[model samples]
Structures are given as C-alpha cells and as structure tokens.
Target: MRVVIVEDNAVLAEGLNLLLASSGFEVAARTADAPSFLAAVAEHRPDVTVVDVRLPPTFSDEGVQAALAARAAVPGLPVLVFSQYVEQVYARDLLADGLGGVGYLLKDRVARVEEFLDAVRRVAAGGTAIDPEVVAQLLVRRTSPLARLTPREREVLELMAQGLDNGDIAARLVVTERAVHKHIGNIFLKLDLAPTDSGHRRVRAVLTYLDA
Candidate 1:
C-alpha cells in the first residue's frame, strides 16, 4: 500500500520510511508542517497515513488538525495516529465524526512490529482499531442519560458512538436492523435529545454522553 508519514522528527521519519518500504509499502512523502502534509496527501492520495499527534511549528495538535482536514478532503482515507501520550479530549475530537478507517496507537506500540503493522493494515482495510487506553478514556464519560439505558441498550449505544450503522450494530449484536434502530430511538429519548435534521447525530450523542 502507498503511505504517507507525517512526523517532525527527521530520524524517526526516515526510519519509518525505510521500515515501511522494506515491508512492501510505498512511502509517498514525509512532511513536517500541516500545509505540506495536506499537499502531499492531495498529490499522492496514499492508501494510509501515519501521523504524529504533535507536529512542527507549534508541535501541539497541528498534526491532528491536519488529519481531520485530510479526512474531509478524502472521505474514508485511513489514518493511524502515533502519539506518546493519550488525551481523552483529543481522542473525543479524533473519533468525533465516527470510527471508520481510523487508528490511535501509542508510539511505543511501534516496538511491537506485529501489532503495529496489524493496526495499520486494519485501518487501511476500513476497520476501527482504537487503543485500549484510549477506549478506557472514552468510556469514562458515562453520560447520565446512558444510566437510563439497560445493558443491551448501552451496548447498542456504545456501538453507535463508535459510528456503526444500524446494520453494523445489528450484526455485532446478532440482532435485526429494526432492533438496532429501536435501540437508537431509545437512546435519543433517554438522552432527551430532540431530533434534528442537522447531520450531526453522532456528534450530538457523543457530546451529550460526555456532558452527562
């Protein structure tokens, strides 16, 4: 697969490039800043992107913002964020739209080549692979509305929060699509959410769950 590496560290970038190349993946580009990253993506449209959570210039969340922008530019583009730290707030924003073709793994994970490569392959294959630590952080919110839900309902809600469609949720729960929709409706009611046509039900549900 063709890949782009967005890391500010020169040595690390070179190492990753060499490693991926040896692993039979094409390295499209290695960039530092947000603009250069976007440009490389536009040009190469790599099958996957390995991005650092912090990048050059400010080294804050520029890489995260760039990843978000890349998603907008190329819907369904696979992205794997490599970071040393796990920030629940950042995790919320990263998975805000829904969890498809995305991965957030600690940089230390790279030492485990088998698992790290598996994560990259999974993301490229249109799968969700969130780090356990990140998942724990996301589960901490436990929105008050979620308390009203039964165990089954919460199971469905968690899948929904992960951006799974009714069909996906049903398959996961071994139920019918109708049942999944029913669970969603119940979630909305329990959360006291007024249905709106705004195109952000997932975002609303997550925000409400976190607030609660």
Candidate 2:
C-alpha cells in the first residue's frame, strides 16, 4: 500500500518513512505542512495518510484541518492522526463525517512498532484504530446524555437547535437532504424521543441537546 507522512518533525518523518518502507509499504510523500500535505495527497493519491495534530505556521490544528480537506477532496481517504496530545475538538472534527477510515494515536503512548503498523493497516482497510488512551479520554470528557449521539448526529442536533430546517442543515453540512433526515431520525432515536410523544420529536431532540 502507498502512504503519505505529514509531520513537521524531520527526524520523526524520516523514521516513519523508513519504517513503512521496510514493512513493504511505499512512502509516496513526506510533507511538513498542511498545504504541502494536501498537494501530496492530490499528487500521490496514497492509500493512507499519517498526520500529526500540529503543523507549520500556527502549529495548532492545521494537520486536522488538512486531513479533513484532503478527505473532502478525495472522499473516504484513510487517515491516521499521530499526535502528542489528545485534542478533543480535533478528534471530533475528524470523526464528524461518521466515516470509518480514521484513527488518532498519542505519540508517547505508542508502545511498539507493531502497534503503529497495525493501526496504519487497519485505517487503510477502512476501519477505525483509535488509541485506547484517546478513547478513554473522550469518554471521560463526555459526561452528558449527548454522549449517546455520534459526532455527526451531534452536529445535526446543534444545527437543529439553531432553528435550521433539514434543507438548511444539509446545505450547511454539504450533505444531501435525505442524509440530513436520516441523521435527525437517528438523533431522535438515540435521545429516546419516542414518536408517540405529544411534543414534536425535533423540538424534544433540540431541547436535549441544549440541556446537554
């Protein structure tokens, strides 16, 4: 499989390149910034991309935004986020599409080379490989009933709370109206807002989100 490495750290990027190359994977590109990473993705069309949470310029969430942009350009493009810290907002944004070809791992917690390789392969195969530590932290942070909803569903609910209709939400999210309807249905179900209830399900769902 082909791979793209997007890390500003030169030594770490080289090490990752060497490791993947030795494991029979082709290192198609090694980029240090979001713009270069997107260019590499467009040019190389690698099977998977390994990204860090921080990058050049601000060194904040550029990597996450780049990964999202690359996936937007090439839907379902697999990505494995290797970062030093667990940026909750970044993780949520990466997962907001509800696509399975994603992962987030902490740099210091990766115990072995095998584990890292396995995460790359799993994400490349359109599966999730989030680090256990990442998952635990996310779970601990979500202390409300909203935790039952997926990231995409939460986004839909938030839009609903803003009084946006299905069409408006779809337009804002760049998704089809049918998809937005499905997400609303899922939100109602997950929030336990039964169809038989006297109050409007959408209103109830929004209330739940606001309360959360």
Candidate 3:
C-alpha cells in the first residue's frame, strides 16, 4: 500500500512514515501543508492519504478541506483523518458523499501502533474504521433533536459527548452542577429520551448524540 502523509508536525509525520514503511506500506510523500498535500496526492496518487484536521495558514479545518478536495479530484481516494479533538460535524462532512473509504482516529491513538496500522490498512482497502469514541459521539439519536436545543444546551451536549461527567462539565462551562443537571434534564426531555436510571439515561443520551 502506498501512503501519503499531510501533517504540519514533522516529528509525527516522520514517525508515521517509519511505522508505515516498516509495516510494508510505501511512503510515497510526506508533506506539511495543504498545497503540498494536494500536489503530492495528485502526483503520487497513493493508495491512501493521512491528514491532520488542522494545517498551515489558518490551521483550522484546512486538512479536512484538503481531504475533501482530494476525494473530489480523485474519486474514492481513501482518507484517514487524524485530529487532536473530536469533530463529529467534520467527520459527518467527510462521510456525506457516501463513498466509504474513510477513517477517523484521534491523534493519541498513534501510540497504539498495531491498531492504527490496522485502521490505515482497512481504510486503504475501502473499509471503515471509525474510532469507537468517535462513533459513540455520533450514532445514537440526536440529529433532529439537536436543532431544537438552545445554544447552551448544545454546548452541554458537546461536552457530554466527550465523556465528561456533570461535575466536570459544570466546571468547564463555568456553571454550577445543579445548572448542568437542569440543562441535561431539559436536553433529555427535548430529545424525548424516556426517563430511566441515571447511568442508563446518560448512556442513552450519548447514543442520541451519536444519531446526528
């Protein structure tokens, strides 16, 4: 498998190149920014492309845009997205076209070398390898109900989706735990999640967050 990497962090890029090469994949190109990434992809037309979620100039969403552009330029180009944080919305954009060769894994997962390599291979083969955390963040019930939420509630949900507990969420949001509790209750009611034990309901809410 031939792979091209587009990441601003030189050390990480070298590490990925070494790992992939050692695992029998060809390291076609290693680039640090968007233009070079696009150029490399077009020139090499590698079997797979690895990209960080942020890149040069703005350093916000450039990598995702580059990946999307490459996929557009070369249909079905397998892409494995790496990000420092969960961006369910961005991941949705990547999958919106419905051409399945996509994978999204957290940057930290690179430490789990074998699984990361497996994700790369799976994506290169046109299979999906969404991080379990990412899926748990996306697939249960919130798509439509999400729109009904006020901005504050939506903020709470975002924090919740990241696996934060109510107390932790309150600290991050600068609100009291009681307020967080009320907001969550309202969120559950708005989403129409039936009343249940606290633990089960939290799990269900996370599931709803996934639905979007």
Model 3 Cα lDDT, one tens digit per residue, 44-105: 99999999976887565778889999998999999999777444455678966777589999
Model 1 lDDT tens row, 87-109: 44455677766645888998875
RMSD of 3: 10.2
lDDT of 2 by residue, 59-96 (tens): 65789989999998999999999998565566778876
Task: Point out the higher-scoring one by TM-score: 1 or 3.
Answer: 3
Q: Report how far off residue 183 is in candidate 2 (Å).
A: 42
Task: Score candidate 2 by lDDT.
Answer: 0.87
Instruction: Candidate 1: give its CA RMSD in angstroms.
Output: 14.6
Q: Model 1 segments beyond 4 Å from truth?
A: 109-111, 140-212
Against the unseen true structure, what C-alpha lDDT does each candidate score? 0.77, 0.87, 0.83
Give candidate 2 regions above 4 Å deviation: 143-212
Each model's backbone clash number: 0, 0, 9
